[model samples]
Target: MAASNSIAENIAGSPNHKMLHGTLQAAGLVERLGGDGEYTVFAPTDAAFVQIPPVTREGWMLPAQKQVLHAILNHHVVPGRIDSAELERLVDAGDGAAILKTLDGRDLWIRRSGASYILTSGSGNKAVITEADLAQKNGVVHIVDAVLIPAT
Candidate 1:
């Protein structure tokens, strides 16, 4: 599973995250994410990306949109490793919901949805944690079903 690799390395090697890997490269965030620091990335899979409107998706890839893309990517990352177990504890402590501060200086609310969990953005966009807790050398990655759009 190459659990010893950094978050960016693992994402780059993952077949399901090809689009995300490329986007990170375009956003110039690969180096920082791969460096020595604890991070939790709610990575959207290739399939999840397909759900976005083609034109909207393509626009984000433009050179002029690099900073915008970076913000979108940063919205998915947290400062520390908040694995599923820890998320559960936090949710319980918050009386069924917890506000996690994202690396982009925004908040992401996590709530229990039956047996699984879901993250709701400030804009009200919801992304279910499809796959959780893929450990890496510096942190972990969780695959989400949808792109989490942060509030403007």
Candidate 2:
């Protein structure tokens, strides 16, 4: 249909982007990802944030928790643009699963669950790709159903 925007701009335009935008801004990563790159961001939707306890989410938003927020957010980002098709291929090649290194330096397990894709966080939390292949000027975005907290 229409040309896609940068990841930051795309997030800004979505209904579920508020919490993510806040976290990105608080982490000081918005400007970085806003620029051109072949990045892949597994963006969690607003509903995904709801899965986190309110107090936990509140704590993460505090200035004192900036580093934690940054790490958590970075865990959702993988370098290079990985679209759904490529991801599927990777999973297929890996026999239904593939390990992806995130910007935070932890591995995220991507697997095929029936007709959809599932992302297993380092902490063992699982999120589904509710929407995929959101093409952006910088890269791509996959709207996920949960926030991926890295294992401690």
Which candidate has the top score in TM-score? 1
| TM-score on alpha carbons, each prediction | 0.97, 0.96
Scored by CA lDDT, what does every candidate get?
0.91, 0.90
Model 2 root mean square deviation, Cα atoms: 1.3
Residue 107 error, candidate 1, Å: 0.6
Query: Which RMSD values do the candidates have, in order?
Result: 0.8, 1.3
Clash count of each predicted structure: 0, 0
Pairs with backbone N, CA or C atoms under 3 Å apart (clashes), candidate 2? none
* Most accurate candidate by lDDT: 1
